[model samples]
Target chain A: MDGITRLVYGIYPRSDELRVLISRTERGKAVTGDLRDRISRETEDLLSTFRGSSDIYSEPCVNWHDFFRPVAGFLTGFSLGKLQRYLQTNTFYREPVIESDLSLRDRFTEIDPPENLPAPLFGNDKEAWLTLPSPHSIFQASKNPSGIDEEKFSDSIFRAYAEIATELGRKGIVLRELFPYSDRAPDFLGALNGKFKTILVAHPESRSLPATGRNHKFHSIVASNQLLARAADSYEVPGIYALDGYNTKLEDAENISRKSEIAREILSVPRVVVTSNQHFDFLPRVIADRKLAVLKSLGAS
Target chain B: MTGGLVTQEIGSFRKPEYLSTVFRKGGDDVRKLIERATLETLGVFRDSGLVNVGVGGEMFRWEMYEHLADHLEGIQFYGFVRSFDNRYFRKGSVVSKIIRKSSAHLEELQFVASHATEKIKVPITGAYTMTDWSFNEHYPDRHELALDYADVVHEEILDLKSEWQKIGRDQVLEIQIDEPAATTNPSEMDILRDTVERSIEGIQGCEFTIHVCYSTDYGILYKALADTALQGYNLEFANRDTLLPGINREQRTGYVDVKEFADRLGDRILGLGVTDVHIDDVEGSDLIKDRIEFSTRFQDIGRIRINPDCGLRTRSRETGFRKLKNMVEAGKAFTDRT
Candidate 1:
């Protein structure tokens, strides 16, 4: 696959139309058919743009930041509501999308291909990816409001995620990748691991260096183990572990190396990738870089 | 000395409940409250027609720490897990789960286009600090986690920028990415600089500021700034010089000499913190003025943004307000002189 395809498949797509859907929801308006159609069309356009591309390794055709602004805007806006819901429902801000947490639609009827998403987006030489907050993120997000029943919340999330996954699969858009952006993400790996080909696990930047010193070390380890164990149980193919570099303390490279070794030992996953300090920019690069290296290593290049 | 009472805007104080809920439950109320209070505080500052308003505290949810922990696994070195169960795992990870169980509240603050015409400063904690403070879990290596944190934050900021754009805001928006850990270690400094640059990249229209303090070595901070994309640096001057044994005093003092250091940093604005958050007695305007004058010797000081050494969450409301008022008065006196 070319770079654009890789990026489209590897990275999560943030659609402006989706943001409009979210905005309308924020305003307490029912999603209009026109708005829904626009969103579906945009999603289809995005999918077609990648599906039409012949070069899988070519540099992406557009600046990623520019391309995803609307999506990011929508997600941010949606986050505001998600956060508000956490406060109203649970009385705290629990991170809803960490690894340890449940899926958003485990019990709900699987997400039917979002009516807005095109049918052919993943038909040929293309893959679709979705990025969700980790289970730990749910817990963290819940911290803002203090009155949630976590067990019940987790159950509902699992139900919702299952529904979404089932629906997406029905649409032929394979959920090939999942990114656990926060500490709490590891908890729900079991639900997502079997469903996706690759799961990207993130680590805290502050702990990678000697400068941080024994702070939050315990939490980091447990989250990783949860993800690894879940992935081990769910997938026949080993999961991929991705690391963040910006928050890592460069002052002590030896210590960082040692930590990395320990992590490798613990996670026991295949294909660990290291990202530059700025992860978003570096994530695409790392994935692209690794894809070629993996092909070459396998003698396919 | 100014005689007016210095009361902190309600937004400046992050109550324990607020912190806990944001950390544990994931509510929107904390952010809503913050936005509401920020507007109220700004109104008070404008209504008082005070020459300057000492922006006091920030709404740092500890849950963010867990979020960081989940994404960055190398933080195990920091020993932050003593307080909770499953120190090995960060608390929240899934969006569906978080939304389902979250207790966060939301209150939207409508920003008038006219209000934003004048510079409105927004502060965000740096990826390094955020990572350092959280219980990271996602990445295997600390350096790797740092990079991921930077990316995550960059994404969030980019998203934030788009939201600002939709509201017709422009470059006058001043954003400060706070990095308390930048001064302490070389590795962290490198990460801080790189992450700050990444965070500021593409968001060209705004005035980007960086706040560096509460560390043993400030020299690293200066060095880090040489590589960052920010236009301003806010340094803590009041308590930086106080001796803290076992910690390198030279590094700390070097960090305090930000004015001289920043001068070498071309076109960078300096926000010199004149008020001490730790000091119980309110610092007089004269003392603050002397400090600003002292800072002038280090660099061609442009427009100075005065503030406290750090957030006023630790102080009584009365003390916090008094200190902020004094700092604002001192800044006005300086601005008038210049």
Candidate 2:
């Protein structure tokens, strides 16, 4: 857990103009190869602007504008839920319902990096990571919360994740960032213990860290600072403190540095990854950029 | 409180798939689709025999918050943001001038009010939810931000009222303010109370109902809101069914706490959620009646209205319609006996 302080940037935010463009394109006919290229290039252009930010800790989630679209195929009876304006921080996806046993309906091949996202944005020579909804998240987030056969559901979700992780790994993706929205990360991670390499568990919600098992093999845990504050002793692995929140105000760099420093002290860990508790997509690009610059400065301090 | 147990929708009916596509094009097709969708929804509610009918917020393809945000200024629709709870927002704000009122809502309300032989209720996202749900970039405090939103809502309600009069619609309809984010940050209860109160203020001649879900701690906020001009409280009860013998509390089941809400706020008309929106299997009318009967243990039967726990947009049109039909049947059966 020592000597491993990596600044991570999970996903990139799209501008309103780009969102309209994407919406129009999505509502239009099937995304042609040309249109896909255009959207990807435009998305890359949006991301390239952030390449100069020294503290842009993580790889740009170039194609993650629709967070759940990639995993939409895993659920048998997948229906998109309405755009959650308030709770989702104002982003929308089909509230996916996993009605039956999970299966790899799609080849799980499209889960890899798009060819258009420039390699330099992939952290130059550094190892780049990819993010996906965890099996637990898919199950917990689904409509069928009860009557889910835990062992069977776990197996199915594990298989789907393993297949996707393997495919991403084959593409030389170094880390697979799995978002475990459930409080059962310890159980879920333990199930995937020896299956994948460099798996990072990031919980978007501010949930208490689960009790650690002896076989807990997740590389790192990313969660809310509040959750970490409540259950820091429960975590056996190094934790990345998500410092920004729904109301995380724009403060001066000094104030941000102080808060970052306090979070570090509270965790009492030598290695700390400063990141937003949720995606910074909620803020305007200017504010998000400013916040990132401050976070980068905090990382430097 | 009324002649029979009132039946209403919590808001948001599923639009036909092609209608969603056509409505986005926005022209003659959009108007036709709105009318068709509105009629289809009204027909479903009317067939269900529901007296306190919803206009079936079919115009909203997105959820309540974003749909309202789309019509207002200062809100920039950011692309998809997904979380564990699957609740995301269009990255925007309530910070700007809300020039665009929800005239589309009033249009739908007018259609329902004119056509349907039942009391039409118009549901809108509440100010506290609009403030609580959005990223508050402009306001110095959430309380002030929520009040700003309240002012906007108040203005919209006034506009809606004006529109309602222009069409000669009923003056005594219901306006439901949905505050799904009310309990998201429970520490802001006073702010939420003030926001709700102010949102419904100055808009006279209609009944105001506040709908908050997923939390029983609404007692605190409900008490504060009760001090205002609020007339009714619509809350989720069936989704949180306590009738289940041994279900865990956290698994989105059981209504024991709803009883608490009912006990605390029983003087007001209570719109009880008798259908669980998350499940696909339509609940039988007997079960719905049982849930209503269970509620009668706490509150007066006449004061109770039946609705699904939340919007039916998440379900298929088939499933949503069937559930509403069952719910209406249950409401009628329960009223018949009572």
Candidate 3:
């Protein structure tokens, strides 16, 4: 049985650093081209390390503003654009920033496999899995109000994703998987999975039925399945369904069991991944106590 | 406690000196005031032969922002700072305090359970609403933050169950997790279900109830109930037409068409709302009875618990007591009909 593994690879320091940078930029701190290049290089290095460490999957490249801009623009763009004009009097095509972000993400496909890394790291046996912030995540981060033209935003996102997938395909990347972090990401999953071959859902809750109203995780999967079925009906590219993992709460053994059972049944996907491993702070102690096996068995290995 | 009603004083902790000095000076005196108010209200209910009493006040008080500021960083700090000015409580602190207050309240409920001949009900703000209302920072993500809050609630439930078991009480301890925010986002239905499951994880042996109402959106809420593992659900059926959207004036008149919705939900216990709390005047007993009778069409509904649309916190003392009396009288009438 093929199992899923969570290899944490992304821009180092993650959103925290990006937030600081954005704040600084807003404060009129000149972020030089060299500084931007250094940040990008550091991020690329992190992704390369994550790719080299395991023969399993490659991590998604991070472009902070790109990942954020489109959804933010869609949700708060009108108001933000108005504010920017009133404040800075600069006219900016927000779409170009979003497009450039996609282009930066696509640049990962061109990254030369590090020379010191073993040949198996770039071999056909290993899959290159990239985790993008789900459109729902973008919406959440942007703090956009509901009832926007989500369909149009989803279309644009899927088109950009298709472009990236096509570029990665040329790089001999066999599989491209997108992980939807938020519960509200099913619609985007529905849209993108049509183009991407494999899709993985990481629902955070361990309990509750998948169809419960407003349960976005369940909704996303259901919507994804529905979209796939519709595409199959229309002779569109048939995507393969992979596993769904649960990022459950601590000490919630019963819910974990319940979720594992449900994943086995409803998620026609190939695997069900669970995590017994705690956060980064607890990793050392967990490994020291040989508790890694417990997590490994749950598919976090 | 008789039929989910317990006679207990609303405990009020002193706020900082800057805000309300009256509550600080009158700690014991305030407790006496609440006790006196509760007894006086109970006397009126008893005179009218009402079986249950609902407390209408903001009883639990703690400076939670100050407590939680001690644990958070940067964005979390800014979030809390923004929330503090808005009078919003932190999710972690609120859950922690609820656990503490509920444990004490459960003991008081057990005391009432022992003395009374009927079941005692304890209502709490549900996990979803708590997540919606509170500032969260413990987890890196919102869903994770919600799960963390649910874990806190689960701990409280386990603690309360153990305390009840130690006391050897035969009376029912109905724990109502109030979820008004369940309707706002359909995606949250899953989180609500997960939170409910976590809240009731180990204590499957005890009676668990969920109360959801007071918001306009029921699309996700109805779906959440279908997917949740809850044993009993108390919904706002009264004033259904007036409050709920998509309902025509014809549906609002004298009765609601919740029977079909309830029937579709299968065997879960249905605690139908018989009185409209949003209204200023207390509903007459006959009107409450009619509402309960209308809900009896759903065959699976067991033990119809009569209640107003929500807590009587907004109602006047006389009005709240009169409504409770009418509700109890209506419940007795329904029991007699059965």
Candidate 4:
């Protein structure tokens, strides 16, 4: 048994100081250099506190407007649309509007590993990774006026994303699918799993597995703790169970322990990562930090 | 109907800076400040020519959830969580059996009852939202938690009714159950229907309306609330609408739901959102008239009402005032032309 491993994902909540600075910068009052340093300061605190304690992680994407927003830079045909509610939560994300057929941006096309991609916060730590909305999710949420081919668009997204992460020289990529998938989503995800160490963070109830790919399995799958608590389920993948990401009420230690025990029994593989279900952006910084502290304590059980 | 197109305030306005300061840092003069702010906002409403002034701009409360949860027992807030619009609100977790510790809107209504010259519509947070926003730590299931919250809403409504009775038994008391979270989650649709129905059970001497804001798919809610006891639906549209001014379908795509709303629940009132609340640029009176005229294709002129997409708390006091004044002017202009 690989026992238990802890992981982190998504943007950390911006500090109130940083929020004020962002407001200032938006109002044309603050300098860019100070804002960058202020943004890094919070992540430095997190990394120093628990750098290697968590096995697989995504750097705090506090600067990105939303999950799919940065992906616009990697593609040729999309721009940020209106802010949409992120699934059922109070959090909102800017929907990408595809005015024309999406193709890999010239940088992603010409450069083998684009040297221009943003530097990873965790550097070359093998467990550190980058995440974006799954191609299926992007396809579903985006407004495609030109009626792009689903399969072709999905291909470009996976190729460009894989190139970006491989060049960033990080471990892998996380494909986050919080909403219900389009019927063809499973097939699109299958193609993405063929490259580099890949992990899929889907809804707790989603039963999508790698449909057809060169790599038959993801390194692991992280899902809501609800998956393991269910009375009946048949899942072939090793699971990283997680607690609610949005709620501020601290999860009970006893209950998390119980769910991990259940995870061991239910998952197919021995390696089971435990973590928070979604990004901490929905929560206050202090509460999310406490929750992460709880996550860190679940090492190598 | 009521002889003219009616104008209403959605819920909270930008509380005057002085009152907002008191609300932020509590002081002995908090009540007095709220009363003064309410009276001041009422004067603004009177000048704007509104038919229904919503508790003189909901001045007694800081926000919907924070204000309502503050009055409820068995709910404890942990810390502030970021809202969809980049603001933060203190979301509570239900720890024990939930009950109404006091009325969220009784005093606001009482003050308005004493002073308001215009018809008053009281906006209370609905059960679905109260349950949806709270962490369900104590309940066995979400439905049970929602039902208990319905009890809390029911009690608050009863309390308001008694106050309304004290002032005017012969007059109709208007209740706007604000459910911004009503259609946000489709899984909770059944609970939303059940809770709205449960909240108004055995209640009388009132005209009930539901105000749902920024819902992703309002079609689901038009169907969901079809079985509820609500008599009106105040939905947000202008927030997503194109800004062009015309009385045709192409120029008025946001009013598409008005047709479905009329087809499904024609008898119920449709509180059409004729202005966007997030932007400070006031919609022209002609734009608001075009929006209203578009809805008249499906719903009758008498059954229609107009308001901002949601609360005006996001806008500055001046911006909010202009938006309201434009809405009232457009409604009057439309009625006069008809």
Candidate 5:
């Protein structure tokens, strides 16, 4: 229990203003000067709020759907569901299927961070983390896996990610987290381990960590849906436990935190980031804020 | 073949404009809207020639979790929790205690039963789906969690049935348990089956049906679930039509092969989905006829109940009406031919 050190918060829900901006942008509505200014101002406020809360691991309001849409032409249900915000979930995301060569551009890799935010928001690139959908998850959800060379394709994705990580690291970014859809981390995990401090946000469904070099922190999405009987008794690196993703009520937040603490204790992993299971975007700002306060209290040793 | 081409909605109806507006308002107005919606839903089914229809499930606010969660005793509505590709309700406790448990759906069901002249089937969110879709703060284990959920659901169903009897309405033809999350975790197969059994344990009056949608990879667990003594297994077929194995290149069409499902289900009903709910494109009567005909080749047509892949909640009011109408027309066409 004593090994549990720092508690880092990441991916807070998008502020209403930011959500409005993103929705308008996605809808192809022309967002001009006033709206842009409003978005920037809102972004600063949201970031400052998160920064004040605790150790900020990731940006509060990054639209992850904007990434990896280049090869969506070959895939079905690869983009956002036009009818609803989430395809099947309440959270907004694009279920990307890497069908072919994952070609990248600077536009895809660049962190806009919404200009006119506070200097700390802009400057703490070193402390900030960039989350990428794992190459393994992309490959698993791919349409025609037989045609693509697994090694080459994974390496290609890793190389692009590596370039981004290198650039971001040069700018002072400390970590890059992979949102893995599958249990198997790509072969390039070892390679990326050599480049930067990697973190794998374990998919709630696939709780098992990929058999790779211990180069990443395992962020576990411990929804109370499953039995706690199989929680990892030990870990190679420090782990993070994210509780209360979709519909966790406030009353249960502390209980979840306590359960997560027990799991952390059982694992005996050092420096766990006790946070929400998924991005807090599904919640309203006020509710998300309340959740953060609750988590901050419960997360503290 | 006694009940001439059995037709049922998979327990959801798209809210019409009038009803949608009524939902925005509250108090007595909401009850009036629910009554109106229930009547309209029955009309939609009757108009479309569907024999067994639901009470619209409009009171559910287009979400299965919200419908039941709001009525439960001890639930903390955490905003959202992700499972696989979707997010559903997360909570501390699904059911802390069952005393004085009441829901608007129960009231809606009573109203529907009182007014409905036709055979009625009620959609109950299954124990597994409720627990699987929620975050548990109380239960010691998954099995215990699911069992607790089963107890709550079982109690709720009994309450509904008890009220139905008290109202002097005819028996509820079927109690459909929608379990979209049942097959997601393979390890929980036994628990899922047990949950279903426990939910419908002593209920004698109505036939029990478990509806699974989106994914069909039930493995050996399908057989296990069937053995739990369910009357029917309502499965999504048309939505998965594209994924079905085709005979040739140009002839890319075939009725979904549910022979294995039929064999596994034995004498139990196979509420076959003849219409696609996920796609906007309306499947013609000819297509439905073909699908039903193909199903007959493997299973007894007498046991086959024509239905859409899942609930019509995601579809528009017009689309749902059209789809149901098309399904019944196709079922009639098939029956005439047979």
Candidate 6:
């Protein structure tokens, strides 16, 4: 706790049992009760791992169809479009067919976050974060058959998020799967300086992190170990969270330990955060479970 | 002489309702059902006048990625992941050293060989796509994993080609390596070239063509694959171009990459996609003719083979049939005029 701030972001993988129940329920074969209990059991296992392993962790979103879908389901002004490949991965999310201005139909927290999460995590919660795709990401993935201006569309999405953060008193907002879809940095990112924000780059490439000017105090950058090893030296950030979320070779805990030590020295920070760089939703439940024990082992020495 | 701008299919066609339902439920005699469905689809292809039938429109398989991953030794599926709205595919993770457990499409080729009178072009999921689609658990890196996959693909193709020869045919097997994931990762262009070359290298008496459709930028692929042993490219243009009939760059904007392909590569075929498969609105033969005529500006008409953008699996059987029929009519129209 003193030298390293272990953190978890993105959806954790769901168990096979839960997956079966979900499919059955969707097909009208099983009831929602069985599905709910299975998700809780899987989520409890995830939470227990976080208790000793990490300082800050988002609720393991075992039920998210994808990162964007859960949030998109609650928001208005969009219809589901054809499946587009999400960045470089094999997995896909339904694209938004933007029909109207975007806004949340209901409170973002109550609709998307699972019911079992601790009540304490919601109001001004710094310990747990609610994750959403950055407005720019949403704007980029959207299909505007009708022409929509970039700033107007993105601001409409950000206003709803701003309301949620204000209503819930959340201190940390994590926006994930970031990319430089446009020529310049997204304007919403500049307005995100008041509280702690962790920007998870989907694939850390030369163009992954958009050029940004920041006066934000608690801004942090988390990315895959491969990109960090290759070209993360020039990325200036207040905090660097390094994790091997993309590859399944149980990450060498020693390498992460060494990276964290170097990060503390180089970034001139006392404690560096660590978490998986992307969603573990596509990984087998067993491998994702094994990763929890590995996360617990970081900075133990 | 070949039919000018020979008509063909890219790969998948929508499975018949009975076969698809039974495929999900998993009962015995599914193989018989699959064969019946395949032959029926073959009937449609024959009536549509396609010169090259692709395993009767890939009827033996559900998807390109799952079909190959199901046959590999090192892959383990987690659960169903959504590839689109409500439709999902099993995305496997490579947990150990990969090896081909069995040939994915040998039985498929054998079936088509026995039934098809026309020349057969077998569409198999290429090595690069297989590697890019799976999660790597064991490989030291993605490059190593892709190379290992390349070996498996080479072996699978050689085995299939041998079976085709045993049938006592004089024709060389035309293999279309489906690589929809080719242009997704720009950093891995070198890996893409290496994997394609390794997959097709030293396979005598066979044609190696790649089917890469709907790429954001086809220029990357044209330049990167110029030196590979690949014989031609099957790409999509109707998805992006305007359907209002015109033969210029403005109307047929999607065929702009034809100049790049012709300039960079020498003497390669172009599987020109002249119809949009995603939409049900059938392009009349005149519209498809316009797209084919549009490509003649950048690529030689002799080197062009006609096709749909990607797969018609997304469309209904009736729609897929009509689209193919119209495309064939379009090709013949171009042929008669020339």
- Top lDDT hit: 4
- Report RMSD for candidate 3: 16.4
True contacts kept of each: 0.00, 0.16, 0.00, 0.33, 0.08, 0.45
Each candidate's interface RMSD (Å, one decimal) is: 16.1, 6.1, 15.0, 2.4, 6.6, 2.9
Recovered native contacts in candidate 5, as a fraction? Answer: 0.08
Q: Residue-wise lDDT of candidate 2 within A58-137, one digit each (tens)?
A: 44554454455456553354555543333333334455555555677553444332212111222232334445555555
Model 4, residue B10: distance off in Å is: 1.3
RMSD of each: 19.3, 8.0, 16.4, 4.3, 6.4, 5.2
What is the C-alpha local distance difference test score of candidate 5?
0.60
Error of 3 at A237 (Å): 42
Give the per-residue lDDT of model 2 (tens digit) for B1-338: 12366778888878887787666567786777777777787777777666666775555344576667777776654344433222334456545545555553666666666777767778878888887667665666778777877887887788777777777754575788888777766677788888877777767787898887766466676666767788888887776564442233443245556566676777888888888887887888877777777667777776777788988887888898889888878777777777
Best by DockQ: 4
Which number leads on TM-score?
4
Full ranking by TM-score:
4, 6, 5, 2, 3, 1
Question: B95, model 6: CA deviation in Å?
Answer: 4.2
Candidate 3 at residue A80, lDDT? 26
lDDT tens per residue, model 6, B93-184: 89989999999999899999999888788888888898888877788888999999999999999999889889876678999999989988
Candidate 1 lDDT, B297-334, residue by residue in tens: 56554545566776665566567666766766766676
Instruction: Quote the lDDT for A16 in model 6.
Output: 64
The per-model lDDT (C-alpha) reads 0.42, 0.61, 0.43, 0.76, 0.60, 0.74
lDDT, candidate 3, at A161: 53
Error of 3 at B123 (Å): 1.9
- Model 3 lDDT, residue B321, Cα: 62
Q: Which stretches of candidate 4 lie above 4 Å from their native place? A: A20-33, A73-76, A101-127, A182-184, A190-195, A212-216, A223-237, A246-268, B1-3
Model 1, B144: alpha-carbon shift in Å? 1.8
Arrange candidates by lDDT, highest first: which order?
4, 6, 2, 5, 3, 1
Consecutive 10-residue window with the lowest summed lDDT within model 3 chain A: A82-91
How far off is residue B265 in model 3, in Å?
Answer: 2.4
How does residue B245 of candidate 5 score in lDDT?
32
